[model samples]
Target chain A: QQQVKQSPQSLIVQKGGIPIINCAYENTAFDYFPWYQQFPGKGPALLIAIRPDVSEKKEGRFTISFNKSAKQFSLHIMDSQPGDSATYFCAASRFNAGGTSYGKLTFGQGTILTVHP
Target chain B: EADIYQTPRYLVIGTGKKITLECSQTMGHDKMYWYQQDPGMELHLIHYSYGVNSTEKGDLSSESTVSRIRTEHFPLTLESARPSHTSQYLCASRGGNNEQFFGPGTRLTVL
Candidate 1:
């Protein structure tokens, strides 16, 4: 059972363009949402994370728009560059201060992003 | 920088052979997890440990076994490798604030 679903399994965009990746989750108990980036032969690294309390969060040119009511979230990369070409994944967890998730992350199908320079 | 490390970044073994994948962390995190990822696919948690002498199977069923005898060391072992077991194995540790850092995954290939 895939708790989280991501669309656009593969995306191609021009440099300096904005590319958006969308994800939808079914588990309402999920409190923490995070996006991770992975390069070839490397492990996934955390890019940004957002809590349900806020509707949006931004870091640098990356923004995460979260809609709690719809149980959907999207990642937007402004000024996409060739360096940003990698696999992206959206994950959710029943996170809490006490570690309700127990460090277990439920990941969605990954999206392979390509930035043409 | 994330201090988590996985040894034998790449491994190729014959079927029916025993292999061990090593993972170590210097951050002293109490929680550690292992995930299996196929090429261009989602990651699935295979195992995890909360602390020494405590290990648990994750949401995904796996034939690999894990042991956590030391806080910084968590190793996974496969008694008999199969072609189907070929995949990338990732190790991660969680800090006090729930920040999980992943190590470069080990790519295993069984023939």
Candidate 2:
């Protein structure tokens, strides 16, 4: 069913620029959205997350802008660095599904981002 | 550091061999999960557990079986390995809201 879908299978950006990645989901029951960053040969780590209640949330140079009605969210990385080159995954989950909402993540395929210096 | 470990990081075996991938977490979390991913593909959940002695199948139907005999340990076993079963398996744990911590993963190749 691919409840969540992400765009731009790959992205290329320069240092000190903003690289944006977008995602959209079909399941309205989903209440939480999280972004994960994965490097080569490593595990995916939580980058930032947002609840539907907020229009936007920012952590340092990373920001998540969410639009509930549109069922969409995007990640913005400011002053992107070469070290930031990696794969990004957007995931969604429902808090009340099957019992404890202990993070059964439905993920997007993934986006490969490249930051050139 | 919060430790979530997966052992046998890489394994290549002939078909029909029985194999088990081990996962353990030191953070004392009650929830655990197993996901399978192909190269450059989305992660698909294959199994999960809420606590010791509890387990459930996930969205993707898998030939793997799992057990939670202890709170920190969750091991996935394949009765008979096949070429179709080759994939990278990831283990994760979370306490709430699906904010999971993932292990490096076990990449298995079945010939």
Candidate 3:
């Protein structure tokens, strides 16, 4: 079973617009949620992350709105630009007390985002 | 940027050949993972290690084997490569935080 599900496999938006990518997870134990951005020929880079304790977290032009009750989270890009065109992935992980499963991320299906100039 | 490295950024091999993909990290992280990713698909965990001398299979069943002989190095070996094994392999390591840092993936192709 896919632990995490993401919608809109691909997205297209104009420069200066706002683009949103959403994700939902099945595991209630998941406590950490993070977003990654990947450009072609490069590895995914951590963009921003949030914990269930907070409703939202923002870093510069990127924001993550998280709803604990719904088990849903979304990434919002403000003033989307051509440079922001890349594949975005949402991932979730539970806090392992034993530290064995620590950092074991369950990733959602990625979304290819394109910001047109 | 994370100081992680993957060797042979691209590899093309014949079927039945034995191959090893190399992953190393300077961050000295205790957790390392191997993930397989295909175009337009989600990343699948194939193998992971908690620290030196410890390795475990991931959610996905894979024919490949991994070894963590050194804290900074983890290598994955395939006894026999198959066309079906063609995919991109990604290496990641995590520090004290929950986030994982990924290396440039190695694209493998088997003919």
Which tens-of-lDDT digit does each residue in B1-111 have in candidate 2?
Answer: 669999999999999999999999999999999999987677999999999999999989999999999999999999999999999999999965557899999999999
Kindly indicate the candidate among 1 and 3 with the higher TM-score: 3
Off by over 4 Å in 2: A96-102
How well does candidate 2 score on lDDT at residue A59? 96
lDDT of 3 at B83: 100
Give the runs in model 1 whose Cα sits over 4 Å from its true position.
A97-100
Report the number of clashing residue pairs per model.
0, 1, 0
For candidate 1, lDDT tens digit of each residue in A60-113?
A: 999999999999999999999999999999998867634545757889899999
In model 1, the Cα lDDT at residue A28 comes to: 84
DockQ of each: 0.82, 0.71, 0.75
DockQ for candidate 3: 0.75
Interface RMSD after interface superposition, each candidate: 1.1, 1.7, 1.4
State the displacement of the C-alpha of residue B31, model 2, in Å, after optimal TM-score superposition.
0.8
**Quality of candidate 2's docking, in CAPRI categories?**
medium
Q: What is the lDDT of residue B35 in candidate 3?
A: 95
TM-score per candidate, chains pooled: 0.97, 0.95, 0.97
Query: How high is the lDDT of residue B89 in model 3?
Result: 96
lDDT (C-alpha) at residue B51 in model 2: 93
lDDT of 2 by residue, A1-117 (tens): 438999889999999989999999998889889999998777899999998999999999999999999999999999999999999999998755666545578999899999999
What lDDT is obtained when candidate 3 is compared to the true structure? 0.92
